[model samples]
Structures are given as structure tokens and as C-alpha cells.
Target chain A: EDQVTQSPEALRLQEGESSSLNCSYTVSGLRGLFWYRQDPGKGPEFLFTLYSAGEEKEKERLKATLTKKESFLHITAPKPEDSATYLCAVQSGTSGTYKYIFGTGTRLKVLA
Target chain B: EAGVTQFPSHSVIEKGQTVTLRCDPISGHDNLYWYRRVMGKEIKFLLHFVKESKQDESGMPNNRFLAERTGGTYSTLKVQPAELEDSGVYFCASSQGLTNEQFFGPGTRLTVL
Candidate 1:
């Protein structure tokens, strides 16, 4: 069964603090890994998509890195505005579908 | 781009009652999807529609949860005789195609009392 597990269910950091959230997955055939940021009362916003191992993508203060077994979302000097639930999802290439398996998000709270 | 839009931001209904949620995808998006996140749970896929066709409905929980995409445009999800477990945030998203990214709408929070 394909599954995704994220570590540190919740994390708190001060403004300008750097940290990383981990997402480990077990899937039949990995097609892509997606990262999203969700605010309190809204749907998630797309962040980055990593296709293969060693692949990396960046946007503003966020960086996503993918590997064979896991992916990392590195936050660089995150500000309070960056506080949100970070979600990691994976699409199985074997399925050839848009049905993505999502991980229970990591709730990040950045305080100023 | 209008992104995705859903109607009735919140709905509070009684168990055994019926409720319908609507979603209007961005114009020109061929793929529309429905997902739900129960309290404390990760958002899970419910179904997918490619234009007016039901591309994938495997993720739907049961027959009581009916989804329709008419005219290859807006879609609707209806829960007949809703259950207490149906309480959660239902999200609607749309993508241009297989390679394009999905755009989400502010979800509709369903509360069954």
C-alpha cells in the first residue's frame, strides 16, 4: 500500500528561524511529489513539484527536495506570514492517474 | 484566471438529511476533482472528472455520495441522507491536464449535527 508519513506533526519557530519538514513515502512507482501550503480557512496553495530523486525546486523562502525514500521542505528564515500547514503528496506513476496520496500535513507556526 | 470556486462556504445539516455542494472550475480546465478532509485527517481524493465524463470515481466512499459534471463545466457532489461522519471540509480543485498544476477553491465546510 502506498503511504506517506510526515514527522513532527507540529513545529513552532521564531521569525527568521530556519527549519525543515520531512515526508517519507512508500509507493509503487513515484511520478511526482507535491508541496502545498494551507492557511486556516482556505484550501491548499500549490508550492513545488519534484519529479525525480535529487530533484529540487524553490519559491521565495521555501525549498523542496526529493529523494528515493523521502522529501524535505526547507524553510529559510521563515516569517510569520509563512505560518501554515505544509502538506506533502505523491502521485503513483503506475496508476497513470491524478489520484494523489497525501500525508497528514505538518502544521508550522512562525512567530514574530 | 478565476481559479476554482465553490458555493455555500459552510453548511450545517442534520444526520439523514441531504446536502449538495457545487464547484465551478476555472474556464478551459479539462480536469476537475473533488477531495475531502475529515477532522484531523489528511485530505483524500473522492473523484475526478474529465470534461463531462466520470474519469475516476474509485475514491468515492459509497453510492450515497453522488457526483455529477454536466456540460463539461461545473460539478456537483450530493450526499443523500448524510451521516455524522460526513462532517468535514470538502475541497474542489481543477487542472488543465495531466501535466498542469491544480488550482483549489476555498473549501465548503460541512457539519452534520
Candidate 2:
């Protein structure tokens, strides 16, 4: 069965602190992996997409790296505005529908 | 460009009632999708539409859920005889093509009592 698991369900960090969130997935024929940031009362905002192992993508203070079995979202010197639920999702090539399997998100709080 | 939009940000209904949610995708996006996230659970796929056709509905939970994308533009999800378990946030997303990253709309939070 295809599944996604995220660790450190919640995290608190003083502003400027750095941390990483983990997303481990088990799927048949991986097609793509995605990262999203969701604010309270709003839908998820797209961040980056990783298509293969050893791939990495970055935007401003965020960097995402992918491996065969897992992915990590590294926040560098995060600000309060960066505090949001970070979500990880995977698309299965075998599914054919291009539907996503999402992990329960990691809630991060960057206190100023 | 305008992002995806959903109607009725929140709704409260009694069990066995009917509720309909609407979504307007970004212009020209050919693929529309429905997803739901129950409290404390991951988001789950409900269905997908390519233009006005139901491309994939294998994720829909049961027959009580009906989704339609009329004219390949906006879409609606109707839940008939809702159950308490139906309470959750319903999200809509769209992309230009199958491989494009989907842009999501602010979800509709449904409450059933």
C-alpha cells in the first residue's frame, strides 16, 4: 500500500532558528513529490516539486531534498512568516490518475 | 492571474441534509480535482475531472458523493444525505495539464451534526 508519514508533528522555534521536517513515503512507481505551505484558514500554496531521487529544489529560505524512500524540507533561519503547516505529498506513476497521497502535515511555529 | 476560488468558506448542516460546494478553477486549466481533509488526517483525493469529463472518480468514497464540472470550467461537489463522518474541509485544485503543479483554492469547511 502507498502511504506517507511525516515526523515531528509539531515544532516551535525562535525566529532565525533552523530545522528540518521529514516525509517518508512508501509507494509503487514514484512519479513526483510535492511540498506545500498552508496557513490557517487558507488552502495549500505550492512550493516545490521533486521528481527523482538525489534531486533538490530551493526557494528563498526553504530547501527540499528527495531520496528514494524519503524527503526533507529544510528551513534556514526561518522567520515568523514562515510558520505554517508544511505538507508533503507524493504522486504514484502506477496510479495513472495523477492523484496525490498526502502525509499529515508538520506544523511549525516560528516565534518572533 | 486569479487563483482557484471556492464558494461558502464554511457550512454547518445536520446529518442527512444535503450540501453543495462550488469551485472556480483558474482560466484555461483543463484538469480539476476534489480533495478532503478530515480533522487530524491527511488530505484524501475524491475525484478528478479533465475538462467536462470525469477522468477519474476511483477515490470517491461512495455513491452519495457526486461531482461535476460543467462545460469544463467550474466544478461542484454535492453530498447528499450527509453523514457525521462527512464533516471536513473540502478543497479544489486545478492545473493546466496532468503534469503541471496544481494550484489550490481556500477550502470549504463543512460541519455536520
Highest lDDT model number: 2
Native contacts recovered, in order, as a fraction for each? Answer: 0.65, 0.84
TM-score, model 1, chain B versus true chain B: 0.98
Tens-place lDDT per residue, model 2, A1-112, is 9999998899999999999999999998888999999999999999999999999999999999999999999999999999999999998855447768999999999999
lDDT of 2 by residue, B1-113 (tens): 99999999999999999999999999999999999999999999999999999988988999999999999999999999999999999999998978778899999999999
- The CAPRI category of model 2 is high
The CA lDDT of each predicted structure is: 0.92, 0.94
TM-scores, all models, native as reference = 0.97, 0.97
Q: Which pairs clash in the backbone of model 2? A: none
Candidate 1 whole-model C-alpha lDDT, 0 to 1:
0.92
Q: Clashing pairs in model 1?
A: none
